[model samples]
Target: MRKRRTAYLSGLLALTVLSGCGSSGHSSKPSASPTAAVSWKFTTLDLGIPDKVLKAPVTGKVPDDKTLHVGVTLKVSDEAWKKFGHGKSPAQRAGDVGKDLGITDAQLQKVQAYLNQAHIQAKTSKTRTSVTFDVKAGQAAKLLRTSFVTHKLNGRTYFTPDPNHPPQIPEQIKPYILAVTGLESYSVAPKARALGASAPGRALPTRAGRCIQRFPQKFASSQRVAAAYGFNQLWGQGWRGENMTVNLVEMDGYDRNDVANYVACTGAHIQLGNVNLGATEPAVGAEATLDIQMLAGLAPNLRIVDYQEDPELLNSGNGADSWAALNNALQRIIDDNADKKRPGSIVSISMGGPEGFLSQPIMQAIDQSLRILTATEQMSVFISSGDCGAFADRQYGSLDVSFPASSPYAVSVGGTRLDLAPNGARTGEVVWSDRSSLSRCENQWGSGGGVSKVFQRPSYQQAPGADNRYAASGGRQVPDISAAAINLPIYFRGNWVSSGGTSAAAPIWAAGMALVNQGLLARAHIFCYGPDTFYHALSAGAANRPYTDVVAGNNLYYPATAGFDLSTGLGSPNLPAFFNTLAANPG
Candidate 1:
């Protein structure tokens, strides 16, 4: 009906399955009937928070006076999800994504009425899908059917909800909702650190053509990136990521001077724009600096919209997570127009933490939100598969997977150790398995990957070459792919620093996806957004030259093999062949 982009879909897509990488002592499922409009009197669906989050110990001392700000999510209805699958025009698709179609005015009024009944005031978002409101420790305990106490994590004190029983959803808004997140409020960041003895980067290298970039510095730049990735052939064919826009969410602001200086230093032709999402502190962090530099460095001609989020919301000394900011950013990207509109080619999120530590409701909420992007909006979202190789577990030796990255719809990117010849030519690459070898910090070596103790194996993942050995576990795996994560220099905090992690790897896939979308924005509604052709191409690369299967190294526990393994996933994409395969896409 919609130009049949669905042809690229390989197998049955478990579009409704909601799970994460977190492990549960036992399985739990939230009850929601799609067809039932049950009574409003005692109609409350009890969705319990995961035990792992409740059981996680805190670190900081609780203050005498502390308030709880619970984040609430209203699920998107099934009708809105059908828009992407059924709609034809961009406007038709954006009609809902541009705004929160999850909750109606009537539903909002009901929620507000409930809030008033509880004597609690809520801060509703512009989309009306997310709300942030304050509640006393006792008030929250009664509202969500959970017990609350102050706990410290990472030296910060905040409220952690211990659900003696599952959370309740009012029957009045039952069938219309998907997930209501924000039971816990802890967000993690990119797992990267400085490479010791960072020096001034090398000068720019000479370029043969006008379209290709020129990198002079010893630090990797946009030009050398093209050469190293075997994109030379495509650049000659006029495929330099023009007419594309990549949406990146770093939850932190970046230095304007640093970005401009990187462009000037590298002679890149890229442009960077920012959509401020209520951030008060405009000061930039090193992570933001490196993220922007890497995107512009790879796809120099591509437009990047850095969706800057509220710093207070991002790192609210009270263990605030990225859910609110990410939701706001994604909604803006979907609804954007006039000067702020982007092409919606791909999204890159280079941050994450242990999936199990994240609450189940939050994971489901994010999963449904991503369903809007991948299944509905037809946009590709590439999330970095964390830097920690498995999670810190001394008891059962469990390898924890990262959240958001482990979401079924996301193309999870791992890390790799890249080696270049003296002349800056590619030599060899391996899985970025560094266990205490790269930093004094723990869990710094290899890329973040492992089995999803939460999510089941989606239908698309059930196909061949998706690690057949793990069928017994019947869960999702961490990284679907990987790219360069080591031996590269990035400009951060006024100095050039060498850094690598899964954070560095995600942008590679995202920028590459932008190039795949170049000259095809108007047809974005027909593009394959999920793990369709790209996964096929990656799988083909293994037997062919387009993919380099890393048969060595491990992510703490799982080993890299000739095929799909948790360490390097399908191994790094071979640029020439990978692009060739993507360009040949009929969509």
Candidate 2:
């Protein structure tokens, strides 16, 4: 096992190095120092295309022509940073830089002038230090080529890097650029293969559907456990999350048809709203489809708001911009909800990069946003703990954790592999494994959990498994909850498909929360429950609930346990009974 772990870690490191090599060229020098003369990055969206044009590509059709988007990374000199009084704090410094850039009202005017002079129509812009402008589809390439030409704005020559002499981005910013652009793994296309016979057949079961199938049976059993625990029961009749709205953040966009089909399969009447943060370009894979479908499946009645950040804006490779996009989305949701006075809003994010690879400033920004959303909106955010385990790389034997989920304010959802009887009853469940093995029985990708090095235990996590001693001893509890994320067959685009990951678990938990919210409303409660209360309620009924304690599983790097192990968290949901309990308690 030790040898295998070393190999896995080595492989993960190699993968990261290779991934870096494939994209922008690697550099040892810091990309852009806050003190650099031309230090700043900006993102713009391509939006002149009609809605019809946007939807066509999503339907698997090619566009009449190619559309290019240029996300520019800029840097200000150190002297400029001092003149602008950009502070040491990431948020403050970024804010200061944004004020210098077009992120402020004054700057916005200058930016608007520039766009007007260029005959460009700027759609919407996000206000992180990096300001993003949405432009026309085909126009971006031209803008990229010419916009960098020194242009006069606000009586000063706002030096735009000549397209012929584009500004160089520091090596560190590359990964972030890859993440925001949704192009990190763009070099790899979907490897198409036929579905195996053992895979779930077409037409799966819905919570309300009558045609019971094996998959439904298993789901039903899980639901029944929640119901038995009085947790999964329906709340007020006619309450379809009318009072609540949810925001789902993901790296790519999904197949809308597949999402609609999944909803039909589940007999859910949920309405999904798509908000394109990125340009109208479709993400290259299934990440979007799976995330949206799972979220809808779990929370059938809530208003599902989907926000897609401009992939090009992210391609600038600045981690701060990614956080800015996330913050922008959250702020947008908050503003929208406030305008409508909708309480109990929630945001579910299923995407994350490795912890060590991210910059401290960016991490701080993320942490601050999480705290703000949790406090002001009373919004419960869910993040996938990770598909990797404690020793993230079993091949190389390194103990590392995934991020965003590690952020104290967000609830981390873990994964589990489930075994079902012929009748759809769950026979057992274990950690989803994704470790490479010679036997090749199952790939060992399991739940990501454990302690944090950077984050101290928050007050809410002061339960049996959470404490200073444990955290000090490198034992922070992860994945406050669990869901079936291993090899589950879900209906997508009128077909049943099998998929699994911490990605699946995050949305599943979010859907469960939607149901709980319904129950809370039924009982005349208005206050949103905190993570502590939710977990306490879950812990109270763990034994009597329909949970199948995963005793015999491993993430390839670590062994699974009977209860409350990091490998599977608190175990998969007893969906039905859990809802019932929420309805009864209404807290």
Candidate 3:
């Protein structure tokens, strides 16, 4: 999977490109029989779009000629899901496994034919259980029997298939199809879980003196980061994330010059690459910069790939075209890896919104897609839990968790406020929360963590340390782990900034996972890709100093406790010790 050595870019770029991105899924049993094949009529699956969204003011109909890209989630048989036990899949490549678990060849052919009859183009995804296509609005509306209408809600404008009218498919194909998404033409805007000054490509002073003088004790230097997280131990042991790649999911692009400058500034050795799924923003955003810079700083020798998505799909002025970009980007990662084009088993996604905000079909499609990565591809995915603590949606008196983060297969990362001595020894750490500084309804920023309103607790999460108070909720607990999220150093745009939040915390876990995989590959001849390895390691007791449990803080609502709690989950990593445990067991 090695590429020709190119000129060193930013340390973050080089390291990030080498460190791959993450994946997800957990069997949510499908009702469709594996052997059933019958001719039928037409129906619609409840998409679960909120009534508030449905009631929004309709601006107008989407242009008939506008192209809309949609994702179709097919049913997976119970027998296929049974094959994937609690830990891993028997299939070596995720793409090949889909035929058994996802859509059969006959099913794909029938669905494609049906869509073709409507002048719509569609094809099955290599990663399985999904079909994607782009079709003109008029054709899509005619086929689904719904008009696409623009709506303005809460100061934001977007569009969807007429909420009053459900999208329908032929009865013969309904059994094979779970849900068809992208008809909404917009995603609940993803919040980048970070806090800092952001200037995409603006020029600013490169000197560290300015930032250091301004932030004082707030920012941690690269050296401090290494010392704080026990990365020094891994580096001394020759495990600096070499022979590893990390994939970063982003909505924007970064400046190579900025990467190069950061690399030079931090003396980080990193290489970077990009794969654009659709039309992306011209300049970089702080979220993308933070992810790259943090990965570059921690795993300097790792390779990073930034998977950017379409900007127009998310922009305010227009929003009725391509809402499936995130799913497209994720599926692309699985396809690329399965094909050995860019084989990265590690992934990090720092963007997400409340789980409740996404339609049920969209949420299911995303979770099921993630299942392919974690169960089939055996990849590790780290997602920022969110930056708004228990109030994930940021609406007062509401408790929630971020989607994808709440997905069972993903390793949800929360945030912590850490105190380190001059020598980089941890003095103390607490759950990150700005409860006192801001209003409860608007600015109560902190690490996102809570009981999921969706997704049952995966088997791995049923371990002894888990919090069962929310057991009746039947949802997975968020933030399986956490890391310091405050005052982490990042070189963004053209200046050094003190960045923090779960956005900054997620990459730390991703970089650390890269090192863990590197070490495991050397000894076990395999990489620990799924959450099984992490849960196993944490369950190992004192044998592995898995995490430094945070028992002293809260994310506004949930308080950190002795073991696993809603806030901060399993606490911050114990680092090299955790790595050593995984290397020895390689579960």
Candidate 4:
């Protein structure tokens, strides 16, 4: 018989506390014995006060403003846990905790009273399991500070490198902290798991080949735009983004067979390079596969470089390590471009995390990398605006924007939904659902868009519609351009998968950039600005250009209007006419 493991609440709590107290590691609760089972529950709160107050005020100046927004986590005791669980997994146990906690009553009242006694006004309270309430700014700080001075709240401990400031974590409760906050860092076991349970066999190239035929029709509007820009005619003269190199940054790795199928279907000869950034296992994962497939289908001749970074190293939630990987990849691209003396190279990043979650150092690193690309005079970076709407799903709501995309120095791509006639002609078009808005997720498809709380409006964005008054003070305008994202069909595996996200939009734009790079190279103008400059030149070229303004459809948050709006940006690019104007003005 197998040896039975003894379980005690104290021992289990100790293990859990040790595991979760640190910023890293998998979240696990104490295992229950056969006599009594242990489980965890998750919840969220509103914390009615503004984030600026709960957090240290900006600029090291403590504001006299006495407001605080505090969200608290309360662990359910063993008895409560048992009562909540009729015998189910932790995921299933979640549903019961909401009711037992009187999540609608008692917990909420407790939160309100705490704030009221602290002289903090309670704006609102949303109680799930963990309750969030807003109070006067600095109230949280006051409570934390006073707790220390009075030598009370001994069970509460804060963690950080600095003595003066650190985030407080209530003692002996791992489940509550994990549920309410983001993870700092983590490491997975050495053994790799198969990508998924169902591994389908590779099939012949029918779907891939069909994608080639369907491409022109599916993107007829974009093709029309390209024709208006003179891309089709330019390609007629043998300039089709043939020799340029494009790199895609993504999590997980791609399927090798799928990539080959896509290449075969598109009739495009592309080189693929996979760089594992210290992943213990293979780099082929879901995200990687999607990016490679889309990029290859769009620009067949462009060399594809896959840079893989360990998910654990960057903190399991896809934060810091992503920035590190991006910087390192850019450096590698720059070095390679110099080695080959290639005139132009474009980097495409489809993966990103919510802003404000990143440390200042990471943001600086991004700025430095962009400066390098700009200074080298031969490189441009393209980043996805994010699939989550402007606020990144409210949980991280703090006037924050998605980074690298929000960085003023880089070209940020938004999304649009396309409608095609039976023959693939443009029947209709609208702002992609992925555009940043509160309703994005509700629609099941949305692109991340919103004003940036961190970056300021750049000179280019100071156009007629670029007024800052429309946004919260200190916020930056976003989504310089838009492309088809909603319900876009791609050849995945043996069948076609209709997927819509900013993930689809970024590569589509990246492919367009690749075509532009080829055109620039052919015209002997290797070091040029991004598509924005190209579009501006095209807009000035001729009134009768092939470009069509998207005036219908909304991102469900913002409407798509005549010219430029946050929804569709400057509308999808007219590739043909765009190329023509570039040839005309080889600046």
Candidate 5:
């Protein structure tokens, strides 16, 4: 969601008008309901596209030969999801998690048999709670009783099932099915939330002090920004993120040379690792390097793992392949920690798409996974709110936030511009909205924050001062926290280039969380604090002072306020204060 955007308001308006006319040249009417001979009665499974997406202009028919990856999420009742979290440890809880969940072995076998009869290659996850498989687009459309077509919206292409016709499943299996994913794919994949003028054809600013000339903003060194946010306070107290591990969920690959250069420049000792879940290592990019180097500069002595997603799955031809890939990586993280009996690790994700850009089923599946990670698995997950301010879908002045950042389970990190004195003390900070000649909006390239259409406000938001004025009735507001995002320098490729986005903000919080976890583990022998704990602690007395309230500026549509607001949520953190507060009330 951090990739530079082109104005698409006019095209989107036209597409919205044209799509309501009728089908876009492909007829995929099923011969019969459920479309196959089965022992049980069937019912329609409504995985309807969001109104914003369903109205997009159809560009063409999906190619029949393109292979589609599909994931079927089996139902685990709310009671079971809550009951499974009662164990003493995450591993102990997971030991019976699959068994306690509703999906029986016989039920899984029945589903597998159905797929085998159709000759589709499929396999269930280790938990036996979900099944994943690959099938041709034509055959999938036939089996799902729908049509596959390509649509163009906001200068990006997406392949999806027909909104007019919903998919059908057996009534017997319907009770066990939560949702399905990978039926919709982005041709232009979601991007990492890092900004820079180093991209090809972008002209650097003529100003000598500006770091990334394309944006022409004055850059702040990573060390200076860290100091302003209280990293020095934590370090002085002997908490340099030791014995902490953070997994960075990334869509692109990074370069080791750049990581090395950044570490050398920052003089931080850290361990680095990578887990490629079928993704190809493309040429080095700014986003991945920026994420790693930012952590390196701040955490000093932490373990970082880059979980890379597949490139093929990110293309237009692969329907929702990127989404499937993300799910797989998430499940792997849970399984790895559980199988090894390791403590819950922090997860940092800097990539996301607007909630409306994705279908309902896709968001539900991802949110379900996040719920397990934060609620059941006890891991702290932080994600970038986005780089498009309130206009995530590129609708100009319209408002929208990104997901899974908007998922109630995630800590949505927003962006801010920090002004530091010569002594590296904080002078002023505001919502990050920078507009130069190359910008598209009056408030271009600001932090992404707004109300979520898909998710309801979570229990934690019920805390005093967490509610926002712009949130719709029962809607979720973002972001949960803010950080210095603008003018942050990172060693990319061969040089120390700088840019700003919620991308930097996410890792900054992740690094801070790692240190906080180390302190908690040392004192209370606890793995990691849950989202609810942080919410309750920060919401309590003013004596704690865990965060510095950001009460200035706006993300186009939402303005910052005295307490919680859509722009900066609880504002930027005071790390030592935050850790001390958590130590006092270690939930």
Candidate 6:
């Protein structure tokens, strides 16, 4: 009997505080019970300020100077922004990314002067990319080059700018202000959970195989991922992400006890890199723990930077009230590695909400940020597509995808279920689309994917067959790639657990990318690789090997195909072959 997170999330998200908090491995509530996933947080947690409070600022029409609040991002200069586009390695990259990009003293003074003129008080970040200021509706209306108005979405009222025109700044400050964010008053939270599900029974094994790592007798561990994906061969090469760094963007806090326990169990050679993106939460569950442990198990020596942000900011758009928290975290990473073209290799974001909830301007803003990281800084963000599958919001019942994943700049990771024989040999893999027809289960969760309504088809995706036969017209495709995502065992918080979702697929890809970066850096002095190189390599492989074609299963809306399909794009990674190819000719 396994516990699932969906059940608890369905009941307003209760949580149990860890006893002796910092001691690590001290959970006040024992999870040894079979139904540990049940909401046993000791007390019911109020979700805080209701959605109606978000609509409080919306006053009839024109807003007062005191009531009108706006969020701003003082971005880099044009030249500094352009530097990230080149394919040079971090060492070869010129200039310190943050300092050069930060608002010059002269520019800051001018902004401060302008704020005084507008009677606005704003806070600036150390990096100067994220700014939070309050201004009269009149001032904000002029700066954004647009006016604010009340809008109705899903029977809810929120404040937003007109859709006809994009935001703009006066010519004098245009050079310094990369973008104007935080226009929306309210934010929408993403409904996703790090839940686990299992099929009825295991399939028959072919050739004898062994589990990846031994676990306690009480819990079951399968090495099908090891035997099937060829992680064994990569591990054998000692390419254990020794020098690479994987920055993970997590929505919730993590349990250090889980990290210590995972390390003790798997002998992972690493510690924690904690970067607080927002105020700390009271208690955390398996999400962060699984992300860290999985990456450590796959690439034990890889340096990890956990960018912990306020989960409230998640699913919030650039203009939304809590938007700056997320933007601040991403920009910090870009600036920290600004010393080089690609200071970091991969960043995994296992959290995202339905794309429909995000405003067009907000989504566009996030897309630009991600593009800067990948196209310019040489980083690939592996984002979990979402666990809600095609119908991100079951209440709406529309085939919508998730944000960040839908962003063309990210490598959206979908899910799959691998069937292994008793011998540990993999028989085949199918989309991890488990909509239980049996009694007692009503969850319609799997992989989130579909043609994006916000983003257009990027040049990298314009290639023939990039869009499947059923591909939606006039939009970008999701899940550029996929991995084994279902019913995998993860060691966390001093206990063994089984879970699956695109959350599992994301880190696996991040680890693989780390391996690729390690290999590329080993052979060349400075390396510049992007989706173009990665996509071209997919077609360049001998008979297009290295990636197993997942022609079975569907995500309720999109089906898997031979080449690239919405379900599992380009299929799962085939190890050394992928890394070798990406390294040898990273054109």
lDDT, each prediction: 0.59, 0.48, 0.71, 0.48, 0.69, 0.61
Return the lDDT, model 6, position 164.
39
Pick by TM-score: 1 or 4, better one? 1
Best by lDDT: 3
Better model by TM-score, 1 or 6? 1
TM-score per prediction, in order, is: 0.77, 0.60, 0.86, 0.61, 0.85, 0.76
The 10-residue segment of model 1 with minimum total lDDT is: 9-18
lDDT of 3 by residue, 252-361 (tens): 76777667777776667877877866553346777778888888878878878788876555564332233366777787777777545222258899878787777777
Give the TM-score (vs. native) of candidate 5.
Answer: 0.85
Q: How many clashes (backbone N, Cα, C below 3 Å) per candidate?
A: 18, 74, 36, 43, 3, 15
Q: What's the CA error at residue 457 for candidate 6, in Å?
A: 1.0
Which 10-residue window in model 3 sums to the lowest lDDT?
1-10
Model 5 C-alpha lDDT per residue in residues 535-578, reported as the tens digit of each score: 66675535978888888998877888887878788889787788
Per-residue CA lDDT of model 6 for 1-587, tens digit only, reads 00000000001011112221111111122123223222212211111223444344444444645255344555656666665454444544445444555677667655555554445556665445555555676677664566666655455666655443334444455555544555664456544346552223322222212223543322223244655777667767766777677887766767776666556555567645777756556246567766876787677677787777666555344236444555556766765665543343678877676676655445554665676667545677788887766766543257887887888778888888777665556778888786664222223467677888777777777433575565558788877778877666764443456766788889987887776666556565434344555576675566436677788988877777777888887778787777666555555
Choose 1 or 4, whichever is better by lDDT: 1
Model 2, 16-95: lDDT tens digits are 10000011111122223223343335443321222222222211211214222323222222443343211121222333
Candidate achieving higher lDDT, 1 or 3: 3
Number of clashes in model 5? 3
Q: Please write out the lDDT profile of model 1 over residues 402-487, one tens digit for every residue.
A: 87788888888888776666566667777776654533334365677778888876765632357567547978886888887765
